[model samples]
Target chain A: MSGNMNLTLKIWRQKNNKAKGELVNYKVADISPDMSFLEMFDVLNEQLITKGDEPVAFDHDCREGICGICSMHINGRPHGPKHGITTCQLHMRSFKDGDTIVVEPWRAQAFPVIKDLAVDRSAFDRIIAAGGYVSVNTGNAQDGNTLPVPKTDADMAFAAAACIGCGACVAACKNASAMLFVSAKVNQLAHLPQGQPERMERVRAMVAQMDKEGFGSCTNTGACEAECPKEISLVNIAAMNRDYLRANLLDSEG
Target chain B: MGVFSFLLKSSIGKKIIMGLTGLFLIIFLVVHCGVNALIFMNDGGVLFNEAAEFMATNILIRTMEIVLFLGILVHIFQGLYLVFENKKARPVSYAMTNGNANSKWYSRSMGLLGTLLLIFLIIHLRHFWYVSRLTNELNANETLFDEMKEVFSLLWVVMVYLLGMISLSYHLMHGFQSAFQTLGWNHKKYTPIISAIGFCYSIIIPLIFSIMPIAFYLGWIK
Candidate 1:
């Protein structure tokens, strides 16, 4: 962590989607190995600004990685080469001195380029808006332990609820598929008693919105899980499928 | 209509559509592969031609073809939609890097490969199915075996079919495991075994189909 090291960066820079983009090269020297990847980028950008170059625009918030805002495709892997860590949490120690890194935005039609390293993720917002929330009458807060939920159900719900909405699953996906993210939301609520009233409507609305947003189908590839900073399970997808099936069947009668 | 509408709206509905339609496609592949395997049975213009013609001209088969088209459309459309949505949901995650060493190769390339298969299907149906419907005399004497052989004779065509089969296999490897899991069939006791079965089916089915064209083109069989 003490020695200075120089690293090469090949970064994708696009003024806009209509404009052609390519990987522009940069070099950094005297970098501490203890610095995170984004922190390293911070060093590089600081150098660029001092030289009158436009600094790289990357999305990040809560460097702790819980916000799911820091998106990057590092050497073709989402969230850099590490597993289960966001870009902000990825430390420079993982890379060798004088190593080269290729950086690009998440590649998918749905995630259009907003800048050099940012994209318009509002489509996800629409899908969430479709049915991501539970409907409850306004009143006093329910007691935390009032519901007699089975341990397994509680565990599964908690696990599903842990999805941080990072686009890593989509970026990691070969087809840019979103099944993991959507499924996590669906599963989180479906497993809980609080999610009952609008369970059917929730699945239906979210799925419709998912389709309307031009996302690809889940082909069951675990790339989403593999690259997920949260390691969200593919099981949520199964749960979503099951809920949708039951919802459709029951709705068919009315 | 409600059932259909429900299918469009729910996660499970999308999944049921995916599962049922996917299984349907799998069965269709089995049957189609079985019929093609007939070419290996007799070394003449008899069995394979008869089967293909029957399948092509039969009322039930035609009805099934229509349904098959519907299934493919739904599968492809829904698949693409979900992929796009997933991409947007997380604006940024991975930094540019090859993080695929930890994941199955099939999982990372299914979409691009599935798109390849779609293109293959279009050309395949056109040359084999649509062309056979033309009233030209050129289309008259072409038997299924002859048409297949003719198609495979082009080295590039055979190559494309080979690539297509590889893509299909990759798709099936992940897809089979997924379809079962979607149906809540994940028994930890049997999940790995089921995954193995799914893997075998993916590889063997496409291998069998890919071989026929290459074998026929190589004149390994009459």
Candidate 2:
């Protein structure tokens, strides 16, 4: 193609969690602008394999943006330098022909890098396990209309539920705070009638898990919301705060 | 109680403390600014001294002063604690970060701004609060306003006050709205209004505060 571009990539190459990492440089040529960022990486890996060099290790499950598995802090931004898109959604068109791209894994104490560009985000899975789900007996599905949900409440819950558990919020935050992700989980349930049964306890447990995970406290900088692939609102954080305060102050069970 | 301990221990709980104490300090600034603004009357410190005496002697104000100090201390201690904890969250630093790509510089810089304000507060308290509240060091004839005149006479002191107000401006700019968010007071309809009010408050209060020392130093007020 006439517009095929060549680029320089400085990728963080780490052996394991205990080993030190460094940015190693490589050049990619004749990259099509239509290729997704991950596809571009695939091309680079193919070249490395052909050359008998170890391919750079990164994480990705779905080429589509929904899976939340693809993570790269490209050029100082989580999921590359675009807004409201995951790394898998980022295209080569976002970069110029001569641009130098730097990619690194999400950097946080809770998320130790497993390899070159893959950090163990099991900390997030544990937080979800803590209380991110509602406890309901496994039976036939309850009728949707059985619980009357206000339209506004349903919409708010839906918005909060869009969070795909990607750790971009953590990556983007200067403190590596997971407030945005935790708030999304908390608020998604807090706004639903089914969520009411364990609303207070859920917030408490999830927050305890979040703190235990060694993620930083939020400073309300709105960085997470800005960089979120799902564009999760910071209002979730506020709602989570309200729920947490109520959980601690007004919950009679304690 | 378990709840009290939760408030003291949890991450969200610590932020709630910051937000509540910050709002209290915000209100205190309004009162402090209003009282100090009386010097603008330029009546050789007569009205200003009366207000100052009333503040010192009033039982209600005296009690609130203790509450104010407690609020300030809690705010300071909690802030320092959070800064320490936040630093530990990211053990491995990014090779490059564009924080300005997502949030305002001042929003990310609350700790630094707050530390500057703390330093300013110490100097400010030493200059006026210590002399007026703790000691009989002031000449009997010199009112608190006269003390202000004497203290602001120095170009360096005035410069420090100006720097302090600048820090206060940025700190309040982020803090006012951040407190509301932390307290779970944000709403789509109400938050914009709160943010606008906060923006004006941050600028106006700090501007008035900066003007005080400048007015004294430049003889704009007697």
Candidate 3:
């Protein structure tokens, strides 16, 4: 069906983490169903600019799901109602004419609200900074098969590397736990032979940083897995637990 | 936090304590159920009382009982604390929540079931353990089976016992495998088996417990 629609949006507006936030309503008319959700927002922003009103603030980049920057809770689910796709991928066609849609930021203690529908996700960057990387000498790229990597290990690592570091997992959890996100990072590195030297230290440092970031503990609720835009598995979490336990048991600190 | 403090204060560490205590209690259920099943012989609780006497009198078993009590206390307190910590993790509620989409309702309601089981445990210990172990005034020799008869005679008491067993069953169903998961006992081939064993054990143990009270109330064993 070829039709343009009128839609109402109730967006969360906050000046900063210290400021109080509330839902502010606005309407956009004659929007083509073909426009992406972010594109629809663009139209609304343009309208606000014409009216000399401050444009709504939100985070996005690449317009694709690759970058984890685009984060928003649409109708209570992260990255909007559709599964496996970020908010930028959601199209106006998913909604009906004259329907009201709710948009909010990822509400978690670690992710303080930055502005309207935008949160400060620097905590994730801090976690990654703690132990998300392996030490490799700076040089030309080595041969891919030099480390005798198994196909299964490579496949599993790739699956975990699919995590965009999006804060959606934290937002979807009832406890606001970042286990899924942290596990994805930990498992991805743990599965690779190149990641061996720092495996124990990596898990410990990352978990410590995660806890320091004030994120809640995971209770295996599976919400993070179900809500992850990458569709990451819960097995990553199990793997992280195994690695962490081994690290603790061995007391490895070399 | 220091290393020991980390174990006590950290989320994953608290989960490890929960897993350990839950497994300990699961084993206790086996012994409890095994001895209680002796009443099925219909010999007027002779074997049941004999076994009960050994459990009460045996020095080794007595020592283990204290450990069991400590484990239960830690499990209850830490479990509640975990529930409380998780609640604080999300200080703000979502405008609309669909938590059921990802996990089982029973798994989420573990806190409530544990609280119910705590109440049941208090009443249960007061009924038998308190008298049998705490004091010699219960019976010169007939405390084991006679106490069961007297307790089951009251329909409300029987109902509470049955309700407690029900809560225990649900709690076990989740706790059994969840404890293992938290302890990193996951395996592709073995986890499913562990889950199945937990499921069957949960049902069978509680059912045996429930049957004893019902049997006594109906005068089937007497």
Best by TM-score: 2
Q: Please provide, for model 1 over A1-254, each residue's C-alpha lDDT reduced to its tens digit, 9 standing for 90 to 100.
A: 46768899999898986777778999999888888888998998899999999999999889998999999888888888888999999998888889988989987767888889887778788878998997775467677777778899889999988898878887777657778888888888888788888888898788778767666666566778889999888878777777776776666545
**lDDT per residue (tens digit) for residues B120-182 in model 2:** 999999999999999997655977988999999999999999999999999999999999999
Candidate 3 chain A: worst-modelled 10 consecutive residues by lDDT = A245-254
Candidate 2 reaches a DockQ of 0.88
Candidate 2: pairs in clash: none
DockQ of all predictions against the true structure, Cα-based: 0.28, 0.88, 0.50
Q: Point out the higher-scoring one by TM-score: 1 or 3.
A: 3
Model 1 lDDT at residue A169: 82
* TM-score rank order: 2, 3, 1
Provide TM-scores for the models: 0.75, 0.98, 0.91
User: Can you tell me which runs of candidate 3 are displaced by over 4 Å?
Assistant: A1-8, A25-33, A47-53, A96-100, A252-254, B1-6, B140-142
Q: Write the per-residue lDDT of candidate 1 for residues B23-114, one digit (tens) a residue.
A: 88998999989988988875765788888878878999989989988988998887776666555544444444464555776666656777
The global C-alpha lDDT for each of the candidates, from Candidate 1 onward, is: 0.80, 0.93, 0.86
Q: Compose the digit string of candidate 2's lDDT tens values, residues A23-42.
A: 99999999999999999999
TM-score of 2: 0.98
